[model samples]
Target chain A: MNELVHGALYGTLIATAILSTIAMGIWFERKFAGRMQQRLGPTIVGPAGLLQPFADIIKLLQKEDIVPRDADRGLFDLAPILAVVCSLGVAAVIPFSPSIIASDLDVGVLWVLGIGGLMVIPTFAAGWGSNNKFALLGAMRAIAQSVSYGVPLVLAVLVPVVLSGSLSISGIVAWQAQHHWFAVWPIVPGLPAFVIFFLAMLAESNRIPFDIPEAESELVAGITTEYTGAKFTLFYMAEYVHTLVGSALGAALFFGGWDGPFAPGLHWMVLKTLTLFVLIYWVRWSLLRFRADQLMRLCWTWLTPIGVALLLVSAAWVTFGGTN
Target chain B: MQSAWLSAFAFLLVSTLVGAGLLGAASVLRVRAKYDSPLKHNTYECGEEPAGMSWMQFHARYYVVALFFVLFDVEAAFFFPWATVLREEGTSAFIAAVTFAAVLMLGWLYAVRKEALEWQ
Candidate 1:
């Protein structure tokens, strides 16, 4: 009974944290991007626009909901719900700190992958249901990207699992805590595997440079082309939420979750997660989106093959006893 | 395990409520002229009148991509269990794993040779 209550409390706390962080993430990204582009961002909302996300949400909620007459109404409505749900699902397994996990599943790493894979479904549904050429086109691009990039993402994540011989995320972190972190412990595989993971993570989450699925200058908002008002807000919220969770998951897996100098705690996990979150936006504002062909080529020919090779190298490292 | 997932279930249920409730609230709270407008409901077509159904046949390429994804994704599942026991199973496990992946690599090679991954 106590365990159940602990899980529920932490689960709710984590959910609230994710939603609020997304609010600040919106403000932070805008401010960060604005500074990079030589302008002030959201200065009017509330003291440097700290409350901008709330303001945006309020404005969107008051706007008239519009579902196009041509759209498949049922699927259109279903997509946004699925989007937010899938993004929030991974939270259940993430160990923010040693004691801050919701479900410490034995196969926690696989849970992340399983939940992450469902993100593609919502994108496809939105595109098809919108009944717009651009929407469908965007969906197709997204599906292709998901398929290609998913391989490398899985293999890269697998590197840590292989070395530690544990599928549970908490297990991996325990292993890393003993060895510092997979990010540096076995640098031969850890460092390269982290690279592949980051690249694949960007693509999987539809972050910039890999955001062709929603490219405004080209696909005219892509899969989000037909959405408006509150539905659009939900989709936007979902994306940010996924990125934040992705940051947290990556930090836990490779950066020593809750393991840092000056004592171990949730603050360290938050710090590393925030650092990666900022890095995502930095990369977004700094680089141009990749050509679709270039993105595919990078994934299949480069990242995937290298990801598998690194997995082998990690195995060799473990087998030959060269690990820390 | 039961208790842990129970919390996860509670979390998911609450999130669903949050998602659905927000959507419901927005529809009720949103502004309208208390009138129906046809123009407001038309699909976006780059400022032009919308045409036929947008859901149509797409490239056969997406199918091939799905094929490849399934091949590797399933192979990936095998690795998790194999990894956890690699320490106990030793080099025999290593060789078996590599050979399994290498055989799958042949299909990957064929896909590349066929240019199945081309985005166009």
Candidate 2:
């Protein structure tokens, strides 16, 4: 009974945290992007625009919900919900601290990768259901990018799992707790996996530098061209939530989740996750978007081979001379 | 010990079945009549009528890419379990794993040479 309650409570807490943090992320992303473009973004919506996300949600909810006249009604209505649900689902297995995981299953890593990757289905559904030329183009490009980049993303994630020797994420965190931090190791050494992971993280979250699917300038808002009101808000929320998930996962894998000294375990986990979140925002603001072909080439030619090589080197390191 | 593990697995299976059944029933019984509309039946546009068909056959490259993806993806899964045990297993096990990886690499290379990856 206690275990079940613990699971339910942590599940709800984590869900609330993810939703709220993502809402904040949207406000910050817009403000930062506007600053980069030399425009003031939503400053009137309460102190430094902190309440902008809330205001935007209220405005959207008040707007008249319009469905497309010729759209595939079922899928059109379903896509945004699917996107939000899939993104939120990925949060279930993530370990916030030693005692704070929602579900500590044996195949936790696989479960995350599997369900998380399904976000593309909803994205495609939006494109197909909207019945617009630009939406189709954007969705097509997105499908290409997601399928291509996702390979390296999974492989890069697997490197840490390889080092840790378990599919369970908490098990990996426990391994990191013992091994002087896996980041310090020399096998597939330095920060190649980390850098690759970061790039893949950006792609996965549909952030700038790899957000060609939703390229505003050329594709006219890309796959989300027709979305409006509360549905659009749901899509926006899902986008931010996915970003939080990617950042947290990256932190857990590379930055030693819940492992800092002088702080409580949960505090360390939150600090690391938030730090990565800020870094993600920094990269999004600091970089320009990549052309579609350039993005594809980077994934296949650079990231994938490096990920595969890291796996081999990591295997060799474990086989001979052992490891920390 | 084995019975304890088996019982735990059984419990998980039962719960999973119950959860799936409940979700299935709830979805079927929902009030669909109240929400049905002409706008809902049509393709999605901001407020106007939609233009044309949303589905178009994409380039053949995506299929090719997907095939290669499945090939390499399955191969990577085998390495995870081996990574955990390698530290204690020593050289003979290392050589066997290496040989296995080498064969897979050869298959990948052959696919590459055969223009399986020529996306252009």
Candidate 3:
């Protein structure tokens, strides 16, 4: 019962935090985009539109749920749930502070990465279950794009794992606390796994510039075209949750999660993750989407080699210097 | 070499079993339903029926690309441990690692020159 309560608390708190972050992210993006484009963004929704995401949530929830005729009803319902669950579950292993983590598995890094792959299952299911051609195509694009990026993303992540000599995320942060930051400390015969990791993360999260799966202009909301109301809202929530998880993972691995001088542990963690989130959005707005072929090429041709090199160099350095 | 290979094998076996088990459980317990309609069955091009089969026979390019990926992926896996030990190995390890990478790169460069990486 205690374990179950812990699990429930874990799920609820993380889900709520993710939803809030995503809400804020949307608000920030809109405001920032408007500023860039010389217009006001949602200023009417209660003081710089701080309450706009809530309004949007209410609106989305109030909308009618529509299931397409001849669609696989079961899977259609299951897809969004799966997406949300997987995305939210990623928070379980993420150490928000030195003291606060949902669970600190020995193989926390792999657990996060592996469960993240499960998020793809729902995406594929959503496309297939919807009985819509666009959704199917969108799903297919997701599969191709994710697989291409994911290979390098995991490879890139291994650089830190090698450096820290541990797959546990907390251990990685502890390693960072002991050593200089990767941004400063070059991993022996230097390789840019961090850059590759960032770019691959952008792709994995299906953010702008790599959001080919949901090319709204080209595919009409892509795989999610047919979803409506709460289901659609869940998908939106899942996307943001995925983004938060990705950003958190990036913070944990590269930026040294919850490691800072001035703030308390959770505060430091929140600050690091938020900074990464902002940076991702900044990059998103600054860049244009890549062509599907180009995205795949970038992953396979450039990132993979860099990731491989980074891992190799880090390993060699560790072997010589002294094992972690 | 033997220890490394054995460890990797063990890791692969354990992860695969766990992954397969979870995937199996998800599949077995999940309820599913079938759907069939002209609109639903057709390929989706913005709600318009698909022009052709999404799975047409491609040229030899995709195959070649897959081949290259397989080769490089395995080689990249070996690079991790080598990286941890690079400085210690000093000149000898560097030389051996360089040679190893160079041989793989040669194949990669050859494939790239042959336009094997090109898709579509």
Candidate 4:
């Protein structure tokens, strides 16, 4: 049809699909977490708790919308809305499979990184607007963690660009299909770069090991401390949506997205993305949170430097015709 | 070229609408209690009466680290163009980028040595 209508229509479709996928993620994590802790977990909601996430959403929506006194009402509302919007925005650029992408921007990698990085904004805003001591501190820690790892994250992502000599996600995937997946062929730098990317992704999403910001004992749920009901739920859902997008982006970058033996299509992309999503839970349930200093040290001293080294090595390899 | 951006803007508008729509529904569907207390709206503290203002000027630790992030993140952005053209430019691009990286690494080392990254 028209540009606005076409974009809106597809955007709605893609955003809804992502929201549903996030619902499934919530169910999967709960079930997985329950089994890990030796409990059945939410089996009462629907058939095997299939509908638990929706049920929870409805309940949350009906709860009182609490805004703390003197809270910056404008920004307090803006933060969670921005968080979810930004998370979903990245999905528009991701090349889900061969022809299944939404926008397919030539600078898809840039799209992913740029929008993904904006996540830091809503968080700091949430804390600032809340005007709570705990929320402010939590926001500080979360922003610190995300920004510190952001260097390595960009550095690591640069490796895939170096290998493929293109900034497009689909371009990288095509190059992998033609030659070898960066995950296996360039054993030296590819593996390490992927590992760094995964860790940075975890830190960016504020998952368990890097979740010092929301260390409930210390900050009382951190940035969302002053938020209640639906606003609070939006903040929570934003993180899950961020993780899901990161996983899909990771799958596209390193795991030879949508490349399979027998049937290569959207299913393989979904499978790979889901596999990484589960890995996130595995890390979350198994590990303890890092001390704030320890987390910063790990990013600056180790991941960032190592990420740079790997990027250089990959670039040198490609410059010298290694990919050819 | 313009179409791409238009579509992206449309996508953004649509997503915002969806978010606002959900929030609106929640506000519409929400339960408003009969009696409200000032205690409910007070910035959350651990049950004891809160003293002083919620906003404080302390905790500048994140400032230095955030500065480092801006430096490297911008530097990282510069690498994207160099990378896309690496295969074409070959060794020359590699050398130039490495020189740039080494300089940045030296700065990072200085930050580490100064204990800027340390939380304390």
Per-model TM-score, in order, reads 0.96, 0.85, 0.79, 0.97
Tell me the TM-score of model 3: 0.79
Model 2: lDDT equals 0.72
lDDT of 2 by residue, B20-110 (tens): 3323443453234455576564543455665556667888877867766676667666766766676677677678777887887777567
Least lDDT summed over 10 consecutive residues: which range in candidate 3 chain A? A182-191
Off by over 4 Å in 4: none
B51-92: candidate 3 lDDT, tens digit per residue = 653333334554555455456546645654554455455657
- A1-324 in candidate 1: lDDT tens per residue? 776676667767888898988888899999999999999988998798898989899899998778898889999999999898888888888888888888888888888898889988899899999988999989999989988898998999999999888998888888888876989878888989888888888998899999999999999999888888888988998888888998988898888887888866788999999999999999999999998889988988899888889999888888877544
Off by over 4 Å in 2: A1-5, A34-40, B1-52, B110-119
Model 2, C-alpha of A258: deviation from truth (Å): 0.5
Model 4 residue A122 lDDT? Answer: 91
Worst 10 residues of 2 chain B by lDDT: B2-11
List of clashing residue pairs for candidate 2: A68-B45, A70-B42, A70-B43, A71-B42, A71-B43, A71-B44
C-alpha root-mean-square deviation, each candidate: 1.6, 5.4, 7.3, 1.4
Q: Model 2, range A117-164, lDDT digits (tens) per residue? A: 787898989888887777888887887788777788877877777777
- DockQ of each candidate, alpha-carbon based: 0.70, 0.22, 0.10, 0.78
Models sorted by DockQ, best on top:
4, 1, 2, 3
Q: Give fnat, all candidates.
A: 0.72, 0.24, 0.07, 0.80
